[model samples]
Target: MKYLEGIAEFCAVADVGNFTGAANKLDTSVAQISRKVASLEKQLGVKLLQRTTRSVSLTEAGTQYFQQVLPALKVLEDAQLAVSALQASPQGLIKLTAPVAFGEAFIAPLLNTFMQKYSGISVQCTFSNEKLDIVEQGLDLAIRIGKLEDSTLVAKKLATRHLFVCGSRDYFKEQGQPRSIEELKEHSLLVGSQPYWRLFIDNKIQSIPVQGRVRYNSGNALCSAAVAGLGIAQLPGFYVRKALASGQLIELFPEYKDKQEAIWAVFPSNRNVAPKIRLLVDFLAQHLVSDS
Candidate 1:
């Protein structure tokens, strides 16, 4: 273990076939590498290299030593590289994709914090409600909510996006709060484009089909319309927590509220994922979880 550095230098010089080339590749002086290899031979109590004034070749012992230790040395080197890469603050451009509203409202601010901590990192964020093929699009990471359909990507659950069946206080008082799922059909339902809301009931997932006078794809639109006394809409807690707390919107069905679900950071599998993606995923997960 103590002579690992020496072994590494010896391997490098042997592999490159010249001390100058090895020194250049290792970013060190040839003299230092030569000394380390000499030290390694002394420590091993055997001559491992046969060096000429102009060129160097492995001796029979050196050849045997190089063949055995070379691969293990490379493995040690790769391990060191991985550790060093992890220790350094992640750098490079990280392209991220997310839902339009969630990215702007939640993820963007957290990304600002991430950028401040990792000044070397640059980010390009695209906000679209549409589901994207992250690998084909060459995205570094993506934020997805609800149930994931793509099994190819690795999904790290960031936080629970607690949803609410909500209405304005005025509308709830006038229409009367629905005490059960069966009564929800009687009320004026405001539809998101998805047209269905999933809830957990009796240890099972229940999908409720709904209709409304007004329909919109955007969560913000649904939230804003509901605030303006449109009707009941199922929306995420982040979209309406402040409103509910401020009495702008009233959360309905406290007894039956089981609509909390997860947000995930998804990325494609790679042989060796760059530090940039790792940092972002970790930072996002930490920030989102802490905030929640």
Candidate 2:
């Protein structure tokens, strides 16, 4: 336990790149932090840091040591927090980000209920279509839609989203329904974000170039245009489910629908995830369902 004291302090110093910053973060005196690190280096029989007045850097050995030990320290810290959480109620400000339409439609309501249930917690949410780096932005969590790229962050599956090729009933009556993917070239198309429509073809993913008289960045706007009999639009299930049910729009090809994508709650990978983040991820997993 005595040896462990400086391990966290050393990591803090490595993270902030300075003793004063680490000391401030740990709420300890610079002298105490310095002593702890010095003691640790003596015990290890190696110099861990090269310190200067302006900044500090790890030695090559120190870098290797930090890489090896950081994960273990994180595990220990998480264990300690897990024990504490069992005795304490969840309480903290959770900062999260999500896409605009989905956030407004679903996440915001879910958070409202979550806050109501956990009176000690508060939430800060950012709604944007643009993807932002959660770690650099200082966000606790983020809701990601569609395919997730290979990343270091942890992702918890929340729901599934299906893409639908649809057109208004009136448009289909006049322009004729496309019986196959090839026929789409003859009809007026409505597109958003991407220039090509993605669909499952021959048991594989296929991208077909799409051109349209109208284009929109917002899914809602694209759905609205399709509903107004402008053209066929490929949109997410959430954006067009109601219209499909109401007879305002008709699903194009059931057999050639795009592959379903997952909605995920993503956060920085850590051994001891905060209770606020854990609870929220669990809550969404339990409640949120696929729109399709």
Q: Estimate each model's TM-score.
A: 0.69, 0.78
Model 2 C-alpha lDDT per residue in residues 87-121, reported as the tens digit of each score = 66788788889999989998999999999999989
Query: What TM-score does candidate 1 reach?
Result: 0.69
Which portions of model 2 miss their true places by more than 4 Å?
1-65, 68-76
lDDT of 1: 0.80
Give the clash count for model 2.
0
Cα displacement (Å) at residue 251, model 2 = 1.0
Lowest-scoring 10 consecutive residues by lDDT in candidate 2? Answer: 267-276
Q: lDDT of model 2 at residue 105?
A: 92
Tell me the tens digit of each residue's lDDT in model 1 across 1-292.
5867588788777766788766754557889988999899999999988888888898999999999997776676568658758665666777779999888988999989999998998888889988876644557678999788888778888887666889998888788888888999899998986788777778776788999898998888888998998799988887888888899998876655654578998876531356677778888888785223
lDDT of each: 0.80, 0.85
